[model samples]
Target chain A: MSLRQILLVLKREYITRIRSKAFILATLLIPLGMVVFFGIVVGISLWDSDTEQTIGIADRTEVLYPRLQEIASERYQNLSDLAEDSLQALVQGEEIDGFIVLEETHIEGQKDPEYISSGSGGLKLQNTLRTDLREVIRNERLARADVSEDVQKIYESDITLTTTKLTESGEETEDDTGFLTIVGFIMGAIIFGAISGYGGLITRSVIEEKTNRIIEVIASSVKPIELLFGKLAGIGALALTQMTFWIASLLGFAAAAGPLAGIFLSEQMSNMPETAQTAQAPQGIDPEMFSIPAIETSLIIYFAIFFILGYLIYASIFAAIGSAVDSEADTQQYVLPVMVPIFVAYIIMFQTMNNPDGTLSVIGSLIPFCTPIVMITRIAITDVPFWQISLSILLMIGTFLGTMWLSAKIYSVGILSYGKSTNWKELMKWVRQG
Target chain B: MAVIEVKNISKSFGDTRAVDNVSFEIPKGRIFGLLGPNGAGKTTAIRIINHILIADSGTVTINGYPVSSKTQSMIGYMPEERGLYKKMRVGEQLIYLAQLKGLSYEESKKKIRYWLDRFEAAAWFDKKVGELSKGMSQKIQFIATIAHNPDIYIFDEPFSGLDPINSEMLKEIVIELRDNGNTILFSTHRMEQVEQMCDDICLFNNGKAVLNGKLREIKQRYGKNTINIEFEGDDAFLDELQDVRINNRSANYAEIRVLNGQSMQEILKKAMNHAEIYKFERVEPSLTEIFISTVGEDNINPKELS
Candidate 1:
């Protein structure tokens, strides 16, 4: 109950953990790791549309080939010297990626055209022919019907889909569901990793104290509950430190990723062979797409609140598990049960992220153990109701207080009892005794 | 006035009563020995007094206040299962423990430096506890216990891991601490330690204090009926000694108990005809014999107790 004693223990636990090689490595290496992983993903996205090849066409209906050739993806070739059977030979010989045969029946628009491919990563070639062939066939048919050239041009224009979110006050704001889903998934993953990862740290430290027989000396100096709080607070501080490093570096990466990945892509493009360059590079992906969307300040505040409450609830339970066992290996049976809720939260998070207001998502976000992750995802994805947020926070705090008392009881008794393999019945007895 | 008192303290773990109605007091500035064999509830009693475990129905007082956080700061306790923080530096670990016991940062550092110097472990100030040898860590553990300079000291088996030279040094330091008006209480089943150092003693067996009194008064009450002889030729005369029990026999000496009005002079007169009598002295019973006689034969198993 004494603040001074608690602080002393806190100081010891903090200093020792901070100075360890593991903490230093994790703090430094994880950010470095994220940068590498992000760079690789960006590289793959950039390279996906950049494949280059020549497409050959055999037009049996003489008039269609010339007009099709006019819409210049200049990588398309007219196979004028080829016999009908030899067009397949050209594609198979690697002289062309694939060949499309346009017949009088395709021009009549009665049937789908045939495009044969060697199928060696030629799916993009088939998709391009499909779109262009349909456009060419539709224009030919329209011209046969005596439609004007200006009307044909108007029919070929592309259409795009956009969404606008309408507020209760009759204002509208542009919303992208893809962007929101990314935000929700990212926040949910970070929360899950932190709680599951740091809870083990609390358990390990308690086991260290018990195995070394230093628990007796400490138990005499301070109350067991004081020791438990100090331990949780100290290690909780370390977890926060690590989490902050990850958040800052990762968010910084998100902000700067456009330019960084752009530099990586250009360097990669310049390294290609001369023949590949002559074959032509396709239009590039927008570099802006690589950057993460801006996050709201209120969401960060909710995340902070939930992350801390969630950590304390789980960390105290881990501490109790630590006190109950003599070795880390003995913690396996207990850790599995604790991990079940986290995995459940993880599995339910995707459903919650997509439909933030659905019944399943609503229930998932309200459960105390799942609230920290699922509720944060909901906030990231859309505007959550004030009552739901408040109730979730209340439930989280209430669960933490309840778990704190239960864990303190088990920890106090278990730390002092040594050299016995404690079972569930024995642990129940300890809880009652405390 | 007694410095520490435990009144009617009883604790039970499951069906086993670890400490049963144990009542004892440690007088100010005196060495009190808590003597008991293994599993005899000595640790449970020490833990209750230290407030590590609260007794089910009893009161423990330090100075005049009941045992609470206030009194907790007034006592130093080194448990039998004591260990240092193995991964931490010697000085840093000591300072942390001292601060927990209510010393300031500056005061903890100062006391730590003084104790490490006194123990000749100043060079190891920055050395990790895991790097130290067993005896070396025992020295560090001792320093940690006393660095705060509390009014009362309780050390359980403080000499268990030390070499003879270090053990002798520790005995001297304990005596010095007592001389400086700090009450000391230590538990040991080793009777020789109690015989050599204790001003008072309490013997426990099966969760009950079997015998309790000043060590001098207890010895006098047992009466001086044993003779210790140091001689050169003790080949066969020891077996022939009449009306006496022989113990602690060796090539040069033997301890003999006189019983049934047997005379020491008659034994000495008989011994002169056989061997050279270098010295003869009558002494109080050894603590081992007293413990056996006090606890009764059925309860005392010398092999296991020792």
Candidate 2:
């Protein structure tokens, strides 16, 4: 009830948390480690040479020999002239990635023939040889009857498909849409990770206090609500600190890695479909989109609303669990129920990635339990309706208040308890006692 | 005037009535001891006083004001659980807790420094509480509890974890605080502590007070008709002496409990006729013996009368 008292508690919480090795490591090292990890992954994916792997040619049919010669001269220039014995030896040693022995299979009543590869890894080679051999054979037959390469080009161009997604704000963004869909999955994953990390920290803190029985001294000096709120606020600040540092470092790294990503992306896009190529083009980096101030403000607002609500929703329940049980060992049993909803939210978010405007996505975003994660994704990709956003916020606030009321009842009853395991019936009685 | 007064305080946890009609009054500037064995509801009673747990039925008043948020500022409580934020430095933790008890930063710092120095723990100012011994933590907690200089203090087993030397030091400070006009309600299972530190005592058994009065009065009222004699005499002569039961005998002396209506002079006369009387004195029963006799034998539920 006293502002000075609450501030004193808050100061203690901050001082203690900041001095800990765990908080320091989480705040600083995690972001750097993540950047290094992702950087390595990206680097490996980009620089790996798939083109250097050699495939052995085994054209026993001799029907496809000329076509194999042409492919070897063009796509595969590093081919060595070796006998079948050497080729089989190379295949067994895996010195060659694979070997393609084109065997002509005579199928009764079939218009053409079938070619098979010696190993599964040579399937691509087999396909290429078969198509080329078919063309050469067709040309030979067609010269007797006349067909041209122009007709083949026209046939291949007819089957390409393109798609588009209109953002809720009505701007056409990412016509390919698959990469944009990953946005929801990423948002859900981030939310899950952040909440679990901070919530576990809060639970650990409560367990520490409980095991130490320091709650007694604290309860004497401050109200339960004051203690609970101060704890949530203090650790919540730590979580935000870590999150901010991570975001800032990531943005900085992305900025620095921009040219590298652009060059690689451009090269990659050249091999991709036209839709993917346009999506990757460097367009000013949209300086506004990268503005720390704007993103920071939005994040602050987002966390301010969701963090308090989400944290209290989790923390109050966690505190209740801390009090209800006598030890940390007992806490593991209660964790699953708390975790399931968040897990469900994540699964639902994954499904919504492709159709952000789908019925399931719309409903999931509206639900308070999933709204903190899903709505953030919605906001990141598209402008959400003010009314819908307001409704979700109100729902979260309402749920938080409701949870607090319930958790306080549990805390009041559970804090002094010992030597016995708490069960559902007893918890129900505690809740109803209010 | 009563510094703290509780009337008909009863609390039940589910089906168990932990505290039943426990009423007691603590007058100003005196040490009031709340003595009880384990599971006798001493903790529940203290928690109710602190407003940490509301009594199912009772009225509690501190300095004529009902127990409320405003009244809490005038009260200092040290729970038996020995709570301290272990990760925090001793000085920082004390200062923070003192501030919470309504002291300003300057007042808290000054008081904390004084107490830390008094306890000879000034060297451990920057040491984390978890690094401190149990005695040192207790010292810090004692300072924190009283830093705001509350009119009423409830110290539940404050000396439980302390060594004899630290216990003596704490007892001295407690007496000094009492002299300085602080009303303290002390609770412990150690009856010797109660005898030494308490002005008045209340003994609870089964959520009810079996014995309650000034320590002097209780000891006197519970006194046995006995004489302790140490004489330069033969043990056989003392053993044959009439109208005396030798409770204990050592090399040159014997402690005799004279029967009711037997005069101490008569016992001395018998002793003198036998041998030279080196020492002869009538004795009051010790508080420890009185407490044990009172609670240990009485199966009758100390009536939970309001």
Candidate 3:
């Protein structure tokens, strides 16, 4: 129980892991890999923009030629006035994405206009040109009919809607679009999942040591609690260091190449014109309003606390199971029940993303078993009650402590057992025997 | 002074009694052998001593106190099954284990370095336990077991994977530890090793100590009636000897096993009358022979013993 003994184990474990090539490689490569993967995707999408298609346009009216040329040059290369036979050949050829034919005839109130396009390729391009030409003809006819251009300009203006929320304090606030919150929920979910995944790795390590009988030698020198805490602290330190490295590398990459990503996004935004400001507000989510959702801190603390306690709880159980059995293959029977809570937490986290205040999310967050992950996601999207957060933390702590107490009992009994299959029933008996 | 005392300890696995009323005392400054074949509850008893497993009944005392944390700190146990983290560096692992046994880091470092050097494993300081050969790993393990200078040492089959040279090396270390006033428990199936190293032993059979006593005393009690008479004895002089079983006879010498009550002096006198005697001396039974005779004739279930 001595801190010195615990630190000795912790120091040994940390040094070994920090020096391991797998750990070092994983720490550096994960962030780099993510950056490279995203970079390549963005690069390919941007590169696709450079290769413009050659389209043929046949204008029989010549009156529609000006508008056609303007739209064609704006979107693609225009090869106007090709012979009918050449147009047919180009439409059927691989050199162009498509061809368009425009025809017009002067009439009293009905000038029948026909637009022909290739059956395959550049449908949006052809559609854009056709719409522009129709607008040009409409305007020309409107002037002929003595209608003013000012009224037409007013008719063509765009409108947008804004949403507001009535708060509990009788104050009005811009209803933060669920988009950033959704993204936040996703981020929290991912972080939770990633941490749990690695924390599960720590559990496996505990089981491995117990199953391999190395814990016997280790426990001989240090107390079981010391060994348990040392491993958690050691692996926790490693995980934290790697997480810091990953985050720093990501920030560094963003710092170095952020403008490039911004430029590409802005260009894409200009082309669409609709979603231009959507990506902006999200990028600029006010730090004051977007102060890491209180739930994140709670989640991080809860996750840290629960991760160690939960891992110790589960890992202690796992270690006991490992000691009772002869090999890792036999560990699955015990692990399945342990993994159920993690799986439940994952499901609750995902479902609560869209409806953080919903009954299911609220209940899930309160459930001691699901709160570690579910509450974190809930905290990201909506303001969780202080009471609820405190309660969940307390419950999680209690569960962790109870599990650890229960599992340590089994571990002390089971570590020397071998060459036998150990199930829950036998484990219960062993616990009872104690 | 006794270093360890086990009084009427019993342990069971399910319905099978692994150790039934097992009791033995390990005196300080001697190699006390725990002799039994595989599955004879020798390992189970050792585990109880190390506090790795609890006994179902009875008590164990070490150094005038009940075996507890304090006793554990003074004890070093090398389990029959090797228990070392394979991925840990040899030197770091030894120091860590030593520190756990209550050595200061500085002391552990110095002791570990010295022991590793003695075992010729100084080069293995940076190498992981997994990277060492079985024998080398065993040496590192032995170093770890003894690095903290525990007053009581327990080694179970420590020579299993060691070659003759390393085996001899370990035996020397065991002897040295004893000479330094450390109580040592040596458990093995090798009777020759027991004969060479142990001052006292308890041979277990069917979860019970079938034979227990000082080694020299046990050998003496098995009798020294075997006389090797190297002489030109008349053929009729052999017949005159009472209750004598001939062990071997040469052209110039004869060896005979006489009954317990029969005197060797009479046989010497009887042989002298018939021929000139060159040599006549009683021979004692080896530990190996005694062990086989004691357990072999006990009518215990061999399956359970194994």
Q: lDDT per residue, candidate 2, B33-97, as tens digits?
A: 99877677888888888888888898999899888766777888888777787788888888887
Badly placed stretches (over 4 Å) of model 3 are A40-183, A207-213, A248-330, A418-426, B224-306
lDDT of 3 at A296: 31
Which docking class does model 1 fall in? medium
- Chain B TM-score, one value per candidate, order as shown: 0.91, 0.79, 0.79
- Model 1: per-residue lDDT, tens digit, B1-306? 989988999999988999999999999999999998888899999888888888999899999889887787788888988787899999999999988888899999999999999888899999999999988988898888888989899989877767997799889988999999999999988887778899999998889988898999999987888888999875598888777877677898888878788988999998898899998889998877777777865886667565
The RMSD of every model to the true structure, in order and in angstroms, is 6.6, 6.5, 8.3
What CAPRI-style quality would you assign to candidate 2?
Answer: medium
Residues A1-434, model 1: lDDT tens digits: 99888787888888898989988998998767877999999999799767766777777888778877787457578886678679888877888877777789988867777667687445666666677787788888888989877887788788998888786698987776678788788888888988888888888888988889999988878999999999988888888787787778777777788778876775677678856754665433356666666677887888889889889889988999999999999999899999998889888898887688998889989999999889999988887899999999999999999999999999989999887657788899889888
Q: Higher-TM-score candidate among 1 and 3?
A: 1
Q: Write the per-residue lDDT of candidate 3 for residues B265-294, one digit (tens) a residue.
A: 888888889888988887886555566568
- As a whole number from 0 to 100, the lDDT of residue A341 in candidate 2 is 79
* Cα lDDT for residue A237, candidate 2: 75
Query: Lowest summed lDDT over 10 consecutive residues: which window, candidate 2 chain A?
Result: A287-296
CA deviation > 4 Å runs, candidate 1 = A44-157, A168-170, A249-292, B225-283, B300-303
Tell me the lDDT of model 1 at A269.
70
Off by over 4 Å in 2: A43-55, A60-145, A156-179, A259-304, A378-388, A418-425, A432-434, B226-282, B292-306
Per-model TM-score versus the true fold = 0.82, 0.81, 0.74
Worst 10 residues of 1 chain B by lDDT: B297-306
